[model samples]
Target: MSEVGMNKRVMLVEDDLDLAVLIQDFLERYEFTVSVVSDGQDAVTRIIAEQPDLVILDIMLPGLSGMEVCRQVRQQYEGFILMQTALDDDIDQMLGLELGADDYVIKQVQPRLLLSRIRALLRRAAPLQFASSEQQSFDYQFGALKIDLTRRMVLLYGQPVELTTAEFELLCLLAKHCGEVVTREDIIQQLRGLEYDGLDRSIDRRISRLRKALQDDAKEQDQVIKTVRGKGYQLCIR
Candidate 1:
């Protein structure tokens, strides 16, 4: 049964007709509006024109590859990206995250689990989600970046930084654990309510995208998010 019915749309881009149909049919049962596409180029156009609530991308396609699509969307669109692909290689997973994919799911996995993951990314996470509304909202500052949990918006040196729900949640999680290293397992358990995955590069990818949104250099910056060797990550809270 499709659990995510109306009020939201899903962009599904996959070249395989059988798989596409299966996924579309499954999602539609719950009330989700799904726009199906065959390749990455069309996926980008549909995303810009329709602005879906979330995106389900395939790594291998006829043209424009999913990585490029993810990059373009990260630059402009603020929405969740769930990559459903059969590729299980580490390089592919790493590339996907480097390009800003929120979650990666290997094909043929349980649909219920995928649905749970989709909701996890789409759902809001923050200090507000953890606390109450009546409590006076406060701002979190780290170098040039500012997270207004009250407003659920990010600001960098006074400039507004747009983030998809997943990206925002990733940021909030790091900020909440500021100055401490959080492992991929810890992040997945806390954010997605699941155990660590062998292919769980989604959290890392979300963090990379958050850095780009905050204009932090991945190779040469420690102001916002700094990687700890053999550890997770640390948000340099100021």
Candidate 2:
């Protein structure tokens, strides 16, 4: 059992009353203060009003689907989002992450693991004290690649590059620390709110997709993203 004094605040959006109550009870024991809501719309409203530290959002709900709820949360709420989704819905999970959700867990996951996930997310969202202030907004130029964080724009060979939300976030993390090898775990922590057990493949897929949009041709052409075998990834820029 967890001490109430050390409890972290959580907003839970789930339609299943029994599940919701059970989760509240269990998390409370872990020293978490949970505010439960049954509908998606209500969840969205309470998120801004309450400004809780974290949100446990289901993938399906009444009035607004869980996906839509996640979208709304991303647009306004800067807090971490842990999406509860059904098993075997890889596509939906990917979509959720792309839409700005931090991490996803199978609905029937062990309560202990769920708690662990919550803690992990909190640690990631917590700001790094040593992060350079100049890191906030800067223009990085490498060869024909130019990235402007203040303007939220990326250019390759003097051509404007379009990126999805997920891809854009990934690029920012990589480009900001150019030429440095970023481990999959660090990348996952930076891009996703929470971490998954088998997400290295997913991050690779996202990097590949981003590379495609950046006009990186692997064969008979130079590319920006350099893959470090058995290590991670590096963005080599001039």
- State the lDDT of candidate 1 residue by residue for 47-126, as single tens digits: 87788888899888887888888888787777778886686565676677668887777877688876766665555322
For model 2, how does the per-residue alpha-carbon lDDT over 16-86 read when each residue is reduced to its tens digit? 99999999999998778999999989988999888888898998899898899888878788778888898
Poorest lDDT segment (10 consecutive residues) of candidate 1: 125-134
User: Residue 227 lDDT in model 2?
Assistant: 85
Task: For model 1, state the Cα shift of residue 85 in Å.
Answer: 3.1
TM-score of each: 0.56, 0.58
Alpha-carbon runs more than 4 Å astray in model 1? 1-6, 125-238
Q: After superposition, how far is residue 206 of candidate 1 from its true place, in Å?
A: 11
lDDT of 1 at 36: 90
